[model samples]
Target: METIAFFNLKGGVGKTTSAVNIAWHAANEGIPTLLWDLDPQGAASWLLDSKAKSKAQPKKILNGKTPIGNLVKPTNYQHLDIIPADFSIRDLEQQLQLQSEQGQRNLIAKLIEPFSENYALIILDCPPSFSLLSEQIFDTADALYLPLIPTHLSLRTFEQTRDFFKKNKLKPKRLHAFFTMVDRRRSLHRLMLAHPPKMLKNGLPTPIPYAAVVERMGDHQAPLPAFDRNAHVSKAYASLWQDIKATLSDF
Candidate 1:
């Protein structure tokens, strides 16, 4: 499977929403998708209509007694499986760190190999941090999608991601940079988009518009298509999925 991680060091960038929606689109195309919720907040799980239990302990994906094959739960939507996030996943970074010291740096890769050929795509909803887990995601992902906002801090975070990769000396792969919740009316937003930050020149061709409909998905517990597929925001999301599929070359 093509393992893709949706990540942003900065939060509230619609990372989870994009992961879930894209997974849906991929499944709609007759490809089975596995959505792994790695965020401690469990927003992706919630969005998938899975109850995220904060107190429940999560199976150790790195070195747990039970293999991950049993953790897979079928989603309400066909061809979409989910690895629900429990708050205990917060400890994954620690476990990964220990595993790293023991010469197993590809903890995630090894943990993921079993399912690599089982699904067409694996969507990882990462936490908003540059922690050990995040590093693992960056290192192992076939593609990394960053949801950037039109703001100075967001740009800074994007720079940090690049610098981190540089420090690690990783060969570049499919890295996507796209603007999210973009407001065209705002002068700052327009300026950022018109000028086109250097990071984005080689990235996505479209910017996701700032639309209330997109935000309403959280409260409504549904994807944009469920509410109104022809809505402006829905169209933007569908188009974004199309572009991502082309970039990934497998959806």
Candidate 2:
């Protein structure tokens, strides 16, 4: 299975929303998709209307006491399943550190390996932080999608992420960034969208516009397409999914 992770060191950039909508699009196309909510906040889980059976589930899975597959729950949409997360996932870093001194770093990769037989695509909705868990995600995912707002601070964060990868000898090419919450009324946003920096020349082409409909995902408890397929933000997400699929094809 091809694993894709939605991550950003900075939060509130539509990371979970993109992950959920993209997974929905893939599932709608008849591809078997699994979305694993790795964020402790459980926003993705909430959006999908899936919740963990118990608060201890994440810790148990991390400690190898519980089979990850057992926690997989089918979503309302066909061909889509989710491994929901809870607040307990916040302890993931601590659990990984206590596992094996040498192999702990690759624990996530090991955990995700067995799912290849069941899923065609696996999406990980990662937490917004640079921690041991983030390192494991970097090593495990085939591609990392970084969603950032069109702002100077967000650009700086993207550069910092690239530098971190380069300094650690990881493949920076794995990163594919796109703009989120873009408001054309703002000159800075418009300028960046029109002509991004050299580093973002290879970034995804579609930029998600700022819209109240996007925020309504929480109220609908579903993906953008499920609620309003013709909405501008929903259309943008559909186009973004197409771009992502084409990009992943090159890999």
Candidate 3:
């Protein structure tokens, strides 16, 4: 199965929203898919209403004498499943630090293997941080999708993230950027759309406009198209997903 980790070091860039929409579209196409809520905030888990329970204190599943599949939970989506996140993941990070120092850990990768057999795609919704957890995520992901806004600050963070990865000698290929929360009324948004910087133009263009319907996704407990197929946001997501499918098939 191909794993796409939707990640960005800076938060509030609609990373989780993009991840949810793309994964939902894949499952709608009858592809067996799973969205891994790797973000400690559990936003993705909350969106999908997954029931996976995590304790406030996470014992290293790798260090523990139990199989990892037990921690997984299925979601309500037909072909889309999810392994929910625990709100207490901040503590999990602290515990992971001890494991990282030992240089003998690959827990998330090992734990995720079972799903590969059944899923056509696995989307990981990661938190906005440059930590060991994020490192492990990059190590396991087959691809990475970065949701970025058309702003100077976002690009700055993107540059730093790239430099950091290069310094660590880990080349995260398949890193693509897409514009989000775009307001065509604004001159800045218009400029970015008309002539996207090299850093933001590595991927296809099917910009998701700033639409209200996307927010209703959570209330409807479904994707944009599933909730309101006629919505502008739904159509935008459809076009983007179509491009992604074409790219994958060619690959």
| Cα RMSD (angstroms) for every candidate in the order listed | 2.1, 1.8, 2.4
Global CA lDDT computed for model 1: 0.80
What digit string (tens of lDDT, one per residue) describes model 3 on residues 1-251?
77778889999888888888888889887898888888878788777767566452245454565555556666666788877785356655665676677776755676678776778888889999988888888778776777778777877887776677677777734566778888899998899889888765456588888988888878977667666889888788888888666546422
lDDT of prediction 2? 0.88
**Candidate with maximal lDDT:** 2
Instruction: List model 2 lDDT by residue over 1-251, tens digit each.
Output: 78999999998898999999999999999999999999988999999999876644666676678777877889999999998985365476677776656554488888888898899999999999998788888878888999979999999999998899899988998899999999999999999998898988658999999999988999999999998999999999999999888767632
TM-score of each: 0.92, 0.94, 0.89
Cα error of candidate 2 at position 129, Å: 0.3
lDDT of 1 by residue, 169-240 (tens): 863455688888999989999999889887665567678888877777788676677667888777777888
For model 3, give the RMSD to the true fold. 2.4
Name model 2 segments beyond 4 Å from true.
55-60, 103-105
> How high is the CA lDDT of each candidate model?
0.80, 0.88, 0.76
Q: How do these models rank on lDDT, best leading?
A: 2, 1, 3
Give candidate 1 misplaced runs (Cα > 4 Å). Answer: 52-61
Cα lDDT for residue 184, model 1?
Answer: 90
User: What's model 2's TM-score?
Assistant: 0.94
